[model samples]
Target: MYQRFRSFFLLAGLFLLSACTSAGITVANAPVPFFEGTIERDIVFDEESKQTLDIYIPDRATEERLPVVIFFYGGRWTNGEKGDFAFVGTTLAEQGFVVVIPDYRKYPDVRFPAFVEDGANAVGWVHKNIGDYRGKSETLFLSGHSSGAHIASLLIVDERYLEDGTISAIKGFAGLAGPYSFTPEAEDVKIIFGPPSQYPQMQATTFVDGSEPPILLLYGRDDEIVAPYNLERLRRKIEEKGGQVQAKYYSDVGHIEIIGAMSWIWRYKAPVVDDLALFFRENSDN
Candidate 1:
């Protein structure tokens, strides 16, 4: 058991180290590339300080409007910042897609529905303003990893959060290792999405129907933090409603590594970047 544990961490460390240069980040505390492109920083999306976002314009500018992707980073609704996901913005933007990463208020400071509400506000803001950054309002997509995915999923499944027109503006939704069907058994999870009865409101599964935007569910087969069952459950629910949904599992990846593979060096682990680009393009109106 000891030897097996040692090997697991050793392999994980090697994989993580491989992406340092490509991501321009060696450690979590290392400076993220804030000046890589035309970055619009700290744009206010709501009244709270945490409800701010950063926009990354593609390197290749064109008169033709580009598709936009509004992404949220995952940290269990208690921790995370859009700055931590600069690599995600830069990589997707480099592919000629306008990317916006938003920061929402987390737990301890607030609780359930607040963060998701902030996500809804950010989407509304993007729908109203992405055109100024050369993005097509009609080609807007939503994506996130883990908790961020949960928030993004909720925005699509629950129409109440977004105005009718804004909901129509969403072309697709992509989630990475999102917990869409869990019942929140852990104390911390219960606190974040609990009172038991309220768990239904926090679940994306509760709102899945054929009316949702096209959905892509990506998961790491080896993920222990969020089991693959969550993906399967959500997929089943969507399919039952005759919704357009697809699920992909990466055998070589775990939770963090699935999203981590977006970096240049980690592409070999999983072609998440290419797959996502294809999914977004195929689902976009343009």
Candidate 2:
């Protein structure tokens, strides 16, 4: 029941243009679709470890084992809430996928690996218990923007998140205008992604081994927040390693426009939404 929007294109269009207004934003707005009788519940991902998850399933979706898509919101690994991503549930779920959005530990509270660990563990819970929501646990796809995307990518490539425990593994991935090979220059940037955080090694580019599942990547040509070179590096890493990765660049769109693509079923300006659905559909374990 988050605030809903009527006009899709204009609102998203204007938001994407405002990427320069702050220290790069992670998650944009959270606008949900009109859904009734949908169920919401929480599950413990790691009880002793203080991990939990929020799952959303369609009212009409019960008989079938629907696909699951887990989302991690972006806030420079600092600030974001599960509620901030309410839009993703109705947006992607309308495509017949069960969507899980979890709030992982953020900066100051913890750091890089913590969020990634929490993300991976959340997926673990989704994998094991999603059937209650009639989710096809075997076909969970991972996605996020900016920092959230970074967490999703690292867990897939690094493999350490599962080293400690069991989490339903990811079958596919979609990154929206993410900074996979982010520049390690600026001081503030360096502190956030550099040095002790294993900045160099944590980059998604360095770990895009073809060993991971297939992927779909989207970015905007005018994204002032994350440099285009970062996207280039990520695409190169994935494609060169024999992994399946697709890119959609909106020459005039900004960083936030990519978020609107989540609502593409309604707006339909970008091909990202369909491309993501098709990616999971084609690669689904169902």
Candidate 3:
């Protein structure tokens, strides 16, 4: 038994090195059972080619409408797809939540507001059509990892990204390893967000005004990619503005492990999935 567990961890570690890629994530989740849910793939959320999403619905018997969570995958704003995150949808759906994973246009091909706008459009689609999937729109939540978290956070805090009604409909937001307050320093990142003049607009912290929905910020103390200060900055800003916010930090988890732990194969590393599900349930009316 110990040998089997060791082999699993070794394989998981190898995949974690390339966790940003679809193949890596797919292989890592290959061993996990999917009998807990059903998936609806390639649902169109907008007119663009990349503006599609996947929905995961629990198979458990329940008359109550399930709360919905729209999750975005991170790839430094350059690469990621809904299909790459089937593990996320499956695990979250297994928790009895309807999960929506959307694909947005990436940098070089597109930039800043374009990707963020795609996220908004995806939410709009979910707001209008998630009822068909047994999801309660009023219990809707937004969540993501890394750059995806940045996108979700911006949507919640910056009213300009989503419609007033849609923004108001959100019950809460959960961000993992988000770059909420980072200034673009790399050339590609700077170009992705546009000029220095628009940097503030790209930050979720810049728009905190005490009126946003409740937020849960989860981060890794050892994350080297995006500094922990990003989470601290956003948390402090929200507190200063009197907005509801909570934070959780995992001591041993890093940038990739923070999200990777969502997969059942690596779940023992952290209780990320349970934490997120609990946070959503705590905030949901249902």
Looking at model 3, report the run of 10 residues with the lowest lDDT sum: 14-23
CA shift at 241, candidate 1, in angstroms? 0.5
How far off is residue 162 in model 2, in Å?
2.1
Candidate 3 local lDDT, 215-264, one digit each (tens): 99999888999998999999999999999999999988899888878875
Q: Can you write out model 2's per-residue Cα lDDT over 1-286, one digit (the tens) per residue?
A: 2344535644554465354423212222323435543647456677766765667777663587887888887778888777656666666777778888887887677755778878877887777788878887677789888888888888777766764333335777888877787766766556666574577677888766787777777788878888888778888888899987777787666666576556532245566667777887887863
Each candidate's TM vs. the true structure? 0.89, 0.83, 0.93
* CA error at residue 269 for candidate 2, angstroms: 4.1
What 10-residue stretch in candidate 2 is worst by lDDT?
Answer: 21-30
For model 3, the local distance difference test gives 0.87
**TM-score attained by model 2:** 0.83
lDDT of each: 0.85, 0.71, 0.87
lDDT of 1 by residue, 1-286 (tens): 9999967855655555645533333432232454356888999989755479999996564687889999988988988788878878888887778999999989988789989999999999999999998999888999999999999999999988999989988999999999988888778879988789898998888988788888999998878899778899999999999999989989969887787777543557887998899999998763
Ranking by lDDT: 3, 1, 2
Whichever of 1 and 2 has more TM-score, that candidate is: 1
Clashing pairs in 1: none
Off by over 4 Å in 1: 1-36, 48-50
Q: How many pairs of residues collide in each model?
A: 0, 3, 0
